[model samples]
Target chain A: MATSIRFDPIRLPPETEVLRGEVRAFLAEEIAAGGFDPRGGYAAERFDRSFSRKVGAKGWIGMTWPRQYGGHERSFLERYVVTEEMLLAGAPTRGHFVADRQSGPILLRHAPEDIKQDILPRITAGECTFCIGMSEPDSGSDLFAAKTRAEPVDDGWRINGRKVWTSSAHYADYMIGLFRTSAPADDNRRHGLTQFLVDLKAPGITIRPIQFPTGKHDFNEVVFDDLILPADHVLGEVDMAWKQATSELAYERSGPERFLETIEVLIELVRVLGAAPDSRGSEGIGRLVAQLHTLRRMSISVAGMLAAGEEPMLQAAMVKDLGTNWEQALPGLARDLAAFADSSPTNRATFDSVIQNATAVAPKLTIQGGTTEVLRGIIARGLGLR
Target chain B: MAEADTIVVDVATRIFQDLGDPQTVNNAGDDSWRAPLWQALTDSGLTLAWVPETAGGSGGARADGFAVLGLAGAHAVTLPLAETLLGGWLLAESGLEAPQGPIAVAPTRHQDRLTLAQDGTLAGTACQVPFARDCDSLALAAEGADGPVVALVAGHDCAIRPGLNLAGEAKDDVIFDGARPRLIAPAGADRDALMLMGAAARAMQMAGALQTLLDLSVRYAGERKAFGRPIAKFQVIQHDLARLAGETAAAVAAANSAGAAIEASERVDAGLLLDVAAAKIRVGEAAGTGAAIAHQVHGAIGYTKEHILHRFTHRLWSWRDDFGPESVWATRLGESVAAAGADELWPTITAA
Candidate 1:
């Protein structure tokens, strides 16, 4: 069978250039105002509500959504430009990044009208934050193994289980969690999982900090102890979260954030290498730049596919598989190339610090947003191999 | 690709399918198939597809020629179609008429240079001149007293010592010892420009070969069984094929972007250089990784000389070395990016 992978070379339209300029200017202003340090990754990992609100004020959040929900109703390409610029500038986007990237779109598609009216505007205004509750104590990549149960209680369901590796759960206003509503059918293990919109401030929920090896408190162990949710909080089908989950991942997996997470290291690499770098340094920089350009083009092509309303799941998985691997490798590559740099270059300290942080953070690039193994499996299915 | 470009690719695909099927060529024990394939390509005006109508060649768009090369790559045709097309384009660049038979360009390597004597003779030794032994003429880009000049010289005037690439194609060294040219004119492009063009051509070809590899690996995985089921049922093999597909997509995307930029630009500029260099480097990387994975998925059958997998993989390896290897291009591109400073990196990439 012909390979289904299609990355038709899609160029961003001219309008994107305008949006990019505005984004750069705004990011420059924010950096100047000491909102975040562009050279450091520490600011990037932190959830800054004020910074998110400012970004929302610029009408960048929920950019592609309808105007009625505080969105500008822009094209995906325009949103693409804004997202990439924010990523490259190291702007503190963690507060609204998840909501803007996937949660808002998921809600717009599957949430009830009242819920949408209540939450979409808050998300667009950067007044609300979202944390995904997919991974659990026993289930990570095998999402169907999730045992977090949601039992019917009075006018709602009570969720009683734990979700591990939940990013931003401690600070999030809500969580779109997956809970087991029924037993799996004989042939379909992926059956019976239901999605629910749970208010994080509700009773009987505990958010314990799960520190990464980098000593970053970006992840949380969220335990739900009979957490009550209204009946209308159920998203999409009652026992079919799997169906609702598959389509939204393409948006999550194929964004610029997938690849540009550690781009500061590359920028630091160039700074350390100087203008007339040695052959080894120059070649290393060149190869990385080339790979980065290729990944961006592929990512942008996927974005264009999304804009055209195509579900390019295989293509999206491929981009993430390659993109994450490349970004993860950047730190080591940068270290090797920078080894010969003058020990006292002007930004040598900054370069060393960035590389150190990137090294510690690189391990999660492949694991956090669906592990490499999971994505490859999805791609394999797309290739008709399974 | 545009609709018109698709038509051009379709035409080339049809020609290759009818005469240059890889399996058919692999099984044939003689040189009987080469003649007809070359004849079909020549009659279709694809050999000189890049040359303008005024230059005594087909007046097709540059993008169309690139698409044809990509098709030639997918088929892994042994004929010197890309070489001939490149040579004709070089001749046409100097306002010279392309000859009727196949032609090869000199100084395929960046360091190899041809010099023009005051007496108007071409003098240089060009190494790794693809298909030089088989070509009827040589398109020489010689450094003249005024500047670089493109000279058309008959192949017989030069001494050709033939060599073979990893794929066993002719990669000869041509020694032009004061060879007189039939026609000579000032070349508008420089050595770098020619190298960029050649790199773009090779990148497109590699992309096509990668596509073929992905298809072959997937098809093989589906049919070949190991433990009571098709090997494709295994997760590891499936992941291998998936990774190959990703590499193949990267190669295609990078090569197509470069080709599109070249077609859209009126002249070769720094922006075009960035696109071409990135394409060459990224596609070359894909070729190496993709080929290894394809062979791994295919097992011993793919490793056998009798298998058609070797044809594409060998050529993928060989093409990466042509028009400068990935390291060389990466080094150049890196230096340029560094010279532009760190801030310009994003702007440079976006421009590409």
Candidate 2:
């Protein structure tokens, strides 16, 4: 057991618990005021600017960044509380989620001073939206295979390529994209790719909606045809984006979002089953709750590790692999457990709609962020199997 | 756990490495290794880790004792170390001193009940009592005339029916009819609390065993060759090992978290129950999944008695059934959650 992974039983501090209460109260007030329907999951359809602004007003976005960069200088655990509470409530956080979760951190870490000063405050205020441009027509999980070129110009670089499955690209003001600044080294295929902060409003950039079967327009294809960017827009060192891209994965892969995506179905299942469910329903609900609780404990442990400045890559991958699979299985289990629920019209209708949405959303839960195979491979590497 | 807590586990691990290596013990195929291992544990005062110093035992922190249990699981030591520590803790709770040798707790099964008669005698039968035949003393939690009472009785005074679990460890049925106790006092805890404690300990052990399974699976995958290459080179074997690692990781997290919560809490509330129940259920589930993958990776070797793998897989299978199986805990946890209603679910979960 020499390679045993450690996920310490890290409990939230008292301050984080206090923050959790405040966030819950804020979400409750918003729900009461009809800011957004709690039933609407935080999909692309739930991108509400006013709700995002309200959340930003609460100083939740960019919570762990430096104060000079408009962050509140909060702990990662505090941000974790806010994020999880929002997800549990199914709040319309899509408008600011990427900026708050990922983009802000990347900018704070890699962007130049002027870019940070200009965009950080706006992001903290929930006025800016971001999209990632890593996945292209040719590259998704194999990020180094990106053919999006950013040839050097006199002033900056001219970008030309297509980025597909870019979530929120249609509405995003900026994109933290990966481009092929040079050819990959023969011995190291992970070389040559570079990260840049591309202004989405620049000329020669086209955003076309990639609608889902339900007519939902979340994914998009962003074509960068001779889009010009200043030299300063290059995030971190050129042709060395691979180094920076991996450092944020532990944070990205192990968040509460990995597991809470389809929680609405479980919650609804409990509601429809009433106070005294039969043995079948009770066992089903218990197993789900137990699994969910275990995942949270593990996720929070990872957050604790992040706060302590230790990168628990193996533990984080384990959490995401288990959490996403648990969430993906929740909708179907809920359907099975609620098979004998009361047939009252309202109960049946509520359960039906929730389960249907959850079922529809299940396939992408494992695919997005990182696919299951990719995550397991990361875990295998951590186990020293490769 | 703090750096200070791991010292206890380190001691246990060293002792086990010296006298209780799984492969060595498996090869011996006799009870010869048991005596020295028990002697080493006793000499180190680990057997009384949970008992207070005033109770004639080592007054270690609860977390330290739990860590030792987890280490015991990792080694798959076929001794009654967990049972003895649990018994000592139960005795200390009632201000009673633990005896010298191994101790087994009674009323281990979920439905089994023992009672303290007004005449100061123990009555009733407890099934699935671990190491009942091997222990020198029996720590019984029984329904007294007034309330719950903790009683310590000599094992030889009771009727013991020897049985074996999946791992061939002693899991016996003990009958106490009019057996007078050496010490009996009102307990601050009930049967459920004891069960929770046992469940948490078993979860930690299962977590430990799961880690070993992962280690064994990974090592075997790397060493065993198929189609002119190490099996680990195959994407499918790598993925299976990864899944095993996931299960192992979950078990460790859940089990350790539950042990921590139990150590931190003052009473057995719903929050504590949720932590303990989740640990048992998740770790038990992990045992099944992890054992299968370990065997799958080893092919026929892991399935044989000669291999050390079965020692762990069998213990994992057996330990899950002790205290209560996953289904029992799941039902109790589900009932508690439903009783709290839908809205309180999130809060209950976050109460940690």
Candidate 3:
């Protein structure tokens, strides 16, 4: 059994807090150049294609990736520097996140040669966007039961079934879906499934945007009604979709983004409170600040683990499970802090909108990667209990 | 501060775990409530871990002794371990070095000047004293012209009027009208350190108690079956448990870091107070959650005194409300963290 993870804190070469300033300058220029509003912060998908391309050109995207993949070959800490800057700036980076962080690396390690050659440069140049198609109606936390079948055809495969919660499908280029290849067996039903890169514009692929509890089209239910795919589009080895999917999840679950999802509002709340604090506001915000710092450290530690070539599934799970709360709690905390005194309708309306749109989604945070119970069970098993 | 502290924590944790299952404690039918565990601690020299090494004590850091007290909390073993270690240390630091056996201190806060004579007299009453009945000696924090002075006296050296809390832990109204006593530390010897040290110790205890209830609730969720399956298999139960574990970890981290920081710091000032306050608030919130969730997980079984879960959960609820509840710290911490030139009310809220 693997032992409990004891992380020694990573000490950075103590740099000036002015690193924040440098990032702000770059983002301010980008925002002005592209006319992005602060209201949406990073959530609006106001993604400037040219701006992202420039950022990538500046050796920011794939900053920590290997030089062989047209990356800068910087350390994970260095990439952290870039990420923190972008987030602090509230720059829209999600469009390039999956491709740069997960799919690009997945291509490097396991994707076939032709597939790697086709996707790596596009991702590095921030020209391509990839959305995950792992969750489905009947099979979300339990993706093994997903009925999305990919029957072998003449040249490639004929896929039929539905995928739910594809976030960027309305605007995305392609989708990476986990498809079942063969009938279930006693040994392992999970083994027959494989990941295939499907073109969003392909025939017989129906993309219906699913309006969520909040009136947002951030998700869609995409159906594959006999959509055909070339044999070359399969990601990694056939019948090894679980491994690839898990790896993608590890990337999504381990990033600084997990904790920073609603941090914009948090900082805004702090800014609104101003430098001087009322007695109640000071203590409430201090606790939140301390909690945020701890989560950031844990998330950074998870990143460090990933950097060292460790899966750290449980550690990552811990970070996501806890990080989700901070995201969900942001609006509520903002409201609570402002409740004691005078608060403008503008901030209240904004906070209400966020709460309406995000809080219900917060519970899904743990469910997205794996359920909290599942993580705890895994942790307990790691601790050697039955 | 030393590597051995980790070893001590490991040892203390193991001993507490071996003894913690309150189920066994309840089933054993031992009502006298003597702790073989406390004796084990005495044997391990944990009792003297915080006592001054100069005053015939094996003094280490305050966290050294407090960590052990935290172990006692985790095990749900109630034997006044913190009270005595803190009390004995107060006594030792008072230049008394007089507590030979298990001695507990009730540090009282009195407004009037304590009339101390060469014959060791302690006069006047101290409000908001904890564990007064359980303590052997009273560590009175007498108000001096400069600051609060700490002194120790026999429990019965003053009147022992009974007082109590919701938890079964005994308390008494401690009165000393010119009753004889011995001086511990001189006035103005960094009572702030003692206060921060206390916060650190209490935070650890509350953190441990939170974990204890977290474990109890999780175990209940796993073993107690409903609808022909373990209730833990449900998504809602899973979510609850996940939230519980997350909060427990936060509390542990806060308390753990605060204890470490208190140990590392040379002085306990506003920053230390803020850290301790933060730890205390988190631990208090964590304890409440643990208590609430343990009951929810246990369903009807938790409400009965017969169940061992109540033993731990009840203690958590009790301790959480004491020592200035979470909101109290919230206001204080809020003011402490406020940028200068802030509201006058902020400072007023933190006047103590």
* Top model number, TM-score: 2
C-alpha RMSD of each candidate structure in angstroms = 1.5, 1.2, 5.7
Winner on DockQ between 2 and 3 is 2
DockQ of each: 0.80, 0.83, 0.19
Ranking by lDDT: 1, 2, 3
For residues A1-386, write the lDDT of model 1, one tens digit per residue: 28835777788998899889999999999899898778657544778899899999999999989998888989999999999898888888889999988788888988889999999999998889999999998899988999999999999899899999999998999998999999998988989999888899999899999998867787899999988899999888988887875557998899988889879899889988988899999999999999998899899999999899898898899889999999999999899999999845569988988988888988889998889999999889988887
Q: Which ranges in model 1 have alpha carbons more than 4 Å from their true place? A: A42-44, A343-345, B1-4
lDDT of each: 0.88, 0.88, 0.66
Lowest summed-lDDT stretch of 10 residues in model 1 chain A?
Answer: A37-46
Fraction of true interface contacts that also occur in model 3: 0.27
- Candidate 2 structure quality by residue, lDDT tens digits, B157-245: 89988999988888999999889999998985667778988999999989988888888888888899889999998999989999999
DockQ winner among the candidates?
2
Compute the interface RMSD for candidate 2. 0.8
State how far residue B48 of model 1 sits from its true place (Å): 2.0
Per-residue accuracy of model 1 over B53-137 as CA lDDT, tens digit each: 7777888888888888888899998888888888888888878898988899887897899998899887889999899999889
Model 1, residue B159: distance off in Å is 1.7
**Where does candidate 1 clash, by residue pair?**
none
Tell me which of candidates 1 and 2 scores higher on TM-score: 2
